[model samples]
Target chain A: MGELALRKPSGTLVALVAHTLRLQLKSALIWGGVLGAYAAAMVASYLSFGDPQQMEQIMAAYPPELLEAFGITDMSTIEGYLAGQVFNLAPLALAFFPILALSAAIAGSEERGTIDVLLGNPVPRWQLVVGSFVATAVSLLLIVFIMGAMMYGTAVLADTELGFVASVEGVLNLWPISLFFGGLALLCSAVFHRRALAIAVPGLVLLAMYLADTLGRVSEDLEVYRDFSVFYYYAPEGSAITDGIDWASFFGITGLAILFALFAVLVFRRRDIYT
Target chain B: MCAVIYTEDLTKTYGKARGIRDVNLTVEEGEVFGFLGPNGAGKTTAIRVLMNFLRPTSGRAEVFGRDTVKHSVEIRSAVGNLPGEFALEDKMTGERLLKFFARLRGVKDLGYARELAGRLGADLTRPMRRLSRGNKQKIGLIQAMFHRPPLLILDEPTGGLDPLVQEEFLRIIGEVRGEGRTVFFSSHVLSEVERVCDRVGIIREGELVDVEPTDNLVNKSFRHVRLVFEKPVDPGPFRALNGVENLCAEGPELRFTLYDDLDRMVKLAAQHRLVNMEYERPSLEEIFLTYYGASEEEDRDG
Candidate 1:
């Protein structure tokens, strides 16, 4: 018989997190590479435009509501341009990385008939929920880091006026909001056994929140409704690039992610795990 | 021997769906216990309850003297389980999967895993998606046995294995028993249970009908008896004998199901100048059908 290690509570959690992270590394890199390349391309496009002032003039003619709707705070600078072109819209697509990953953690594992074999070991149910969330949270940061590198690297090569710190703030701010959606997916994943519902619930929420917050910015009548949308708290008016990351919203969105994950832990702990 | 597993009135139900009900069972240490039932007979449900995968609707269960629900992790630490239906990660090779599980289990060595893989002919190098059903089953079995856990809870363990692999698996079960470890496996395959199980629990329609020594369950059940007289004899005397049932007479041959009173039947046959005699013990499958035949019909009808 092989020698067995004494089962420690912390050790099990670490092992689970490490295992889940390892499985998620490839997907994270692929997501990061794709989105990073897009961000880098946006930086290149900004540089290719002959003069920043002329580009700002053209953007100014587009109307303030249209600019606000697109989350363009200032188009005269690369920070503003990349914020509008990449980071603002990036969460809409990039958030799905963690959303898809976290949703698969529980409900997806059940659908695939893989949960039984995994939970058959000494893993606690809460560990499955928390470990997946922690790993995915880390994976989300990796994606953000990769996007940051690509965006900043392109800015440096093109001699754009974008600051390294501003670029860092722009990409770093994407983490919490993306993770907030991932948290919802994890909650859904825990509450339901079907993976489709887990993904769809969060997907629909992401679309609705984006539209509510975007339209709220364009119309006074819809302004109150923006408070209900998570996007309301995610980089309002592209402030993360100009004013640096809003510490309040950063932690708030992160807090919400932890809240949803906590709820997931509670719900998953009480329910019977199928398959 | 102390009880390794004990459950009292353990029941689990899925809304209107039937699950196990009032299942009280005790499995002693170092014994191979077989849970026998056909499909949808709550065998999997019962096993799930024991594993704490499904909570009981009423009553409770225990393993290693600890509550199944509260001490599940500790119980699982000492147990090796193979679920009735499971899928390994498609991207993971069998070796990688085992290593991951070993890490989770805090086991540092893969030597036993490798040995079991070799013995079972499990190809650990290939990804799970590339393996056939039988090959997947071999991996499943290896994972359950590799850690050398004290209690092995295997559900429908040999479902997809070929005969040769099944034989090797039974041999492994024998070795597990030799090591004084307990095995609790559920299967609808009667011959497999008969070959390895010391005690067999028969469940029907979401309830345990009987639990007895395998030998007793097989031996005490009815057998088929045939007698050939010198010439055509009246079947009345044979039918009148105690415990004789379903008597049939054709020419000089007499055949019937004998449930009891073998001595009296033999004496009666001797009086008729029995030219030949054949007595055969029924298989466990036949015995299961015979014992539960009425309830099975009632289930089908209602």
Candidate 2:
């Protein structure tokens, strides 16, 4: 075979990953830019909260249970206030980017009738699953880095006190959580042929977990269920911005992401590609 | 001769819908094999199984002596496939897409790819979304044939092309054959298959009905025969001929299908003052209908 004579023993996986990453770069920049702008706006608005005590007093007027439900512990500092405002809620929206992208990796391609052409190459099925997950994971990190740079740059331009290290940690903390949902979406994409189902399943799970972690804080009866939520493990409240990275929650979430990705590879390898 | 494509009792079932059943076939090396079938006749299903896109429900398939499922990557390494219904990335230009595919296949040189684009008149600079269906199909054909693989599996390869472009594609297939590479393609168009394929396999209702050489298939089928006399001739003698079917007789005009015994029919017509005769080959569809219709009749008679 003349074609076989040119074959390399490896690098197909790397090429697949690189190709997927290149395809995702434009979307990554778009998602990162939008989220980063939101973060920059939040940092700029923090300048209006002139006195920490005054801002604390205003936040204290709200119901304590509602504040706790929203993870609003202390607005007395920029990190504390922004943590509850940005990092706490940003992952809920940002995770969907990966969810939408990863859901389309396999099932969405099949729906578009593009999977046949992609899989027509000699790349292994597992490589498709793993390569897509790896590319999306890297793209998620790019989004986080962009958002972090925006947050820190805005702080420096506004002459605010948001430390570069803390901002980096805060944005990087979103990676594990967002990637967790991305992994779930990958698994769903592998298991289901319908792209809508792949997206909707993980999307619903994200919403339910958010509600479980949020409502569980307000209701005594629901508190027991908080541990079941992925958000429970993702306690970025004072951990990311104030103290440091919570290695336990960080590795725990990352581990779950890896698990879901492995499951996706296993499931996808055996299934028929409809497209 | 070693078989380039082999399947033994290969079957695939999608829920209640029949995909393919007991398909045992072998396409030897260096021959152009045409898979002929109507829509929903399991042509795509069988091709998908061979590509390992769909798993076989039972039995097995092998390409170049490697099991399709066990060594799909190795098999695919030697094969180039063009799907029946395929879409490229809308944001990507054809040049970029081919380069990416080349990278995946570890193909360093794009000289052949560029040559294919030139020959097929594919616009590699434009994004896939901007191209018309025929343009996209040109790109699709280029991508499949560019690598010069050992075997090419194309499904309805000429779906959206003008006649001139279709002629160009046939020439390319002929060249591939001349190079001793195998081409196994599926199509509903019989004329193209007749022109390019060495052998044609007819599939009907999820089963392989027949596989025969192109000449044998065309020669064995019936032909449309018309006879005109100077005056109204008796239709009785012609009607009594053994192989004549669907006989129709009017004043000075007689038309019927002749299956065999052409000489006997010619001698019978010689007795009358034969004014003119019109003998034409039946179309592939007509032959297909006759084949299936006779089989169904056989079932009823049994």
Candidate 3:
């Protein structure tokens, strides 16, 4: 009918995501608080052991099990630990903040019955999908930038100088990491219309990936499974925290984010527009 | 006739459950046609199919000669819809919703929208969550009619308005008719349809029973006459009267409904000292049950 009514680029969908992200900016505060506490602890440990060898010794004694569980190993070393400790906490921060924001974004509209009115309008179905995806993507990037700044700001207060390069690398990890989950969250929101699943679906998937990564690290038997986990692609171990930035992994994860977002769009097109 | 809306053996089924079955209807240009039916009787489903909200299982339906799915956007652009299951964005005020609808339809000026809001008592400033259901219905109506589309596919368009507001809505429909545009409305209220619609299609259990003019229906369907007497009434004299279908006599009055002409009947009532007299039209529900019968099985068996 008249070439599908000249679909708009979905400004409304973008608007929905932007509003959701703005509501969760305090995530930066949460990320900052965690980084600040870790920085404080690192400073005390550094003061106790003035020797570089002693610093390495104390770093080895750090709870390897807990550290491994969180995908935080290389970050424990003096040079590497500075960035690792800050970026390591990102997955947790993302699992909480942006999810709370998404809970209000997708499911919230349908819960209030506003989805019916939107469906009645001339707005195309895919626009709703992509608009929401773009909105959350933009928001997740903002959270990353804000938290990155906070981590850099916290690293400055450390007695041991972790240079700007290390700090930049630490904060940069948040982009790819957050993008993976952000796309996943949008996908979940598209699938489910409940606050619990809207947050839990993506959050659990990310957590499960981190857990799978840990299990793989403890034994070679599960190593192959790591490739399937988005967590593995999120922050490639040999990248920033290992002293070299992995552009391949970084861009690969970014590409994965686009793929996840595209999947969300495709799924939304076939499914019934919720009443 | 060039039907503004029509269907050819149209059917829509949701999995094993049927939504509308073989619903074939045609509304002439400029006539106020009422697609009357009870709740869950496939009225809304049929409307949804016509709007391309749902795909038909079999048969075909077209609006302005365009397939609903292929041309919903084009057909919808020319058609205004007020969904039977009314819902609107709560964060937006009545004014904002109107503006949004107007803008969605490409209304460049707020003046026209403002005029409709004023006439309909729609407060555009307050968010939709604060407005009453009647107010919400008003907003929906304003959006539907503001564009002044030549065709309207309204599903229970006046669900929540008070009687006065309902009358106001009817008056607007009358005006729409005067402008020579087709107003295709569905409602559970039979009298409303009887009062406004030039022709009506009574639907029941996903099937259309009959389609005819309101006046012809009123004249041929049933005739009800109320006669209040000066003294206690007797059932015997009234029941024996010619053309009497049903006659019930109370102690002091007779309330009876009869078929055929009333000239001889009125003379019979005058013979017995009548205190007051009244005549009534058959309700839409009466015609509804009469035409569609009761159940799907009953209609099929008939």
Candidate 4:
């Protein structure tokens, strides 16, 4: 057989991303379908709450601070209802998909003894890190879109006041925050050899930042600490569905995710991979 | 002939743990170089260093005349590597995995890959999780050979293979050598190395102890000498001979291991009326044992 010309690093990166995304397709769908169905169910359940005044009374029984902690402003509207029911909690769960996927990018593959075979094909180390991040990012978007479509479909079916644009904005806002955590997982994956540490560090940070953000909403003293959390810039007061998407915070959070991914590439490139 | 692999004082230390140290070696182009060692003897470590999986702590190596560290991707582009320990994705079938790798290498054809799969009996349709260890080894072998790279660096290539498969693998290695491709094969199994390797480098305790042509390594080593005399002869005279050990005598039969001074032993044996005489070259495994045993005894004496 005649020799095949060597592939450029860019070609390998593209192939890596394509293969990773293919591997993640089933997972993305499962995550998206489960979360999307739950969001849709929430949209369906909103219609059974009776009249607006009765819903107001039901929401009024709960403490305002408790409501604010969960990002629930007006439970009567579909936007406010989903803001608390799905969008707020979805990221806490959705973030894990990428966290697991991206963590598996370097450290997890190393532990599994799979990296050597893949890297044996003339792939640059940076391409591995970058390809994983990009693939997970795309998968995250698919999950968010699925969730958004389900929520929107249910809203239309239930004849609720939720606009298509509002549903898109709300779901779109979940992307960066979820990806930010996923990026942190990638960085951890790059720096550490064990996949458990890669998953745990980002996982612990996810819960802690969430707690800080939630408690900060309920307590004035802790509110200052929320500024340091990625969740702080996410959806403040369940506003994305009520209002439009927060473009500044959206880009800022996505930029932070990209930054974490970049740091992952740097660390992964220098370290020795152990299986 | 040009050198395909060159290393000068290559060292890799793992924070007080034992790794390869200052190992100087060379593998010429198209030569079948066997890296022989027991487990944890730095065979894998040295191969890993050459593959650029582990950065050298000191000194350097070059593959295909390119510095291993600086041009790792380029080196890898022309090298087919089978790591000693590896895992395939549980969810992917062998066919899918190869296609994915084929895409990565920019190889347009899967014809060679399919042929290899057929030859190795690699069940390309089954997910890797379901394959047996030996079966997985077959897939690993196929993936490394399918690309037809210039250099094949295989670590414990026949680790879990059955005898028939090992024979087939040796045949494949021979064919690779015939095609002017270099194979840097590592294994603790002496017989396989003896059969295929043109030159063998024996590593022990994280250092290369010897590197020489396979024929030279075997022929230049000790021999097993047996002598049967017409009448019962005094074993005392033969026992005191230089470079002779384990001299056992029963009636007229005398058997001993001869490391050197074969001429003196022959002369001493001629003093008795010899009925039969036999001198046999040791197998590679015996030669390897003798080599290791001598070194170990020296170490103990110190």
| Docking quality (DockQ) for each candidate | 0.38, 0.51, 0.24, 0.43
| Tens digits of per-residue lDDT for model 1, A78-193 | 88788788877998998899889999999999888889988889999999999999999999899999989988888788777789898889888999999999999999999999
**lDDT of every predicted structure (CA atoms):** 0.89, 0.90, 0.69, 0.88
Q: What is the TM-score, restricted to chain A, for candidate 4?
A: 0.95
DockQ of 2: 0.51
Task: State the TM-score, rounded to 2 decimals, of chain A in model 1.
Answer: 0.95
lDDT of 3 by residue, A1-275 (tens): 22223333224444444433443445545655555456556545544556667656765787776556555555335545554554555566665655555454456656665554554555565665665556656656665556555555555655456566765665566677677776776667767767578778878787788777767766678888888876676565643645556778788887877787777677655544334
Report RMSD for candidate 4.
3.9
**Model 3: residues >4 Å from true position, as ranges?**
A1-60, A74-86, A92-112, A149-172, A175-204, A238-245, B221-227, B260-267, B271-283, B300-302
Estimate the overall C-alpha local distance difference test score of candidate 1. Answer: 0.89
Tens-place lDDT digits, model 3, residues B1-302 = 46888899999887888688998888888899988877788898888888776777889998877777776666776777887766676666766666556556666677766776777777778877888888888888877777777788898987888887788789888988998888999987877887899998878878887788977766666767888989876767678877786677777778877776577778777777888888887766676666555766764887
On TM-score, the leading prediction is 2
User: TM-score per candidate, in order?
Assistant: 0.90, 0.93, 0.82, 0.91
Q: Which regions in candidate 4 have their CA more than 4 angstroms from the true location?
A: A1-10, B220-244, B247-289, B293-302
List ranges where model 2 is wrong by over 4 Å.
A1-9, A236-239, B224-244, B249-255, B260-283, B293-302
- Which tens-of-lDDT digit does each residue in B1-302 have in candidate 2? 67988999999999998899999999998999999887888999999999999999998998888889998988888899999999999999999999988988878999999998888889999999999999999988988888899999999999999998999999999999999999999997778988999999998878999999988887788878999999999898998998998999999999999998899999999999998999987776677777854564676898
* CAPRI grade, predicted model 2: medium
Per-residue accuracy of model 4 over B1-302 as CA lDDT, tens digit each: 88888999999999999899889999998899999877888999998999899999999998888889988998898899999999999999999999998888778899988887777777999999999999999999988988899999999999998898899889999999999999998987767887999999988878888899988775667878999999989898888888889999998899998888888998988887889999987765576667764565688998
Order the candidates by DockQ, highest first — what do you get?
2, 4, 1, 3
In order of lDDT, best first, we have 2, 1, 4, 3
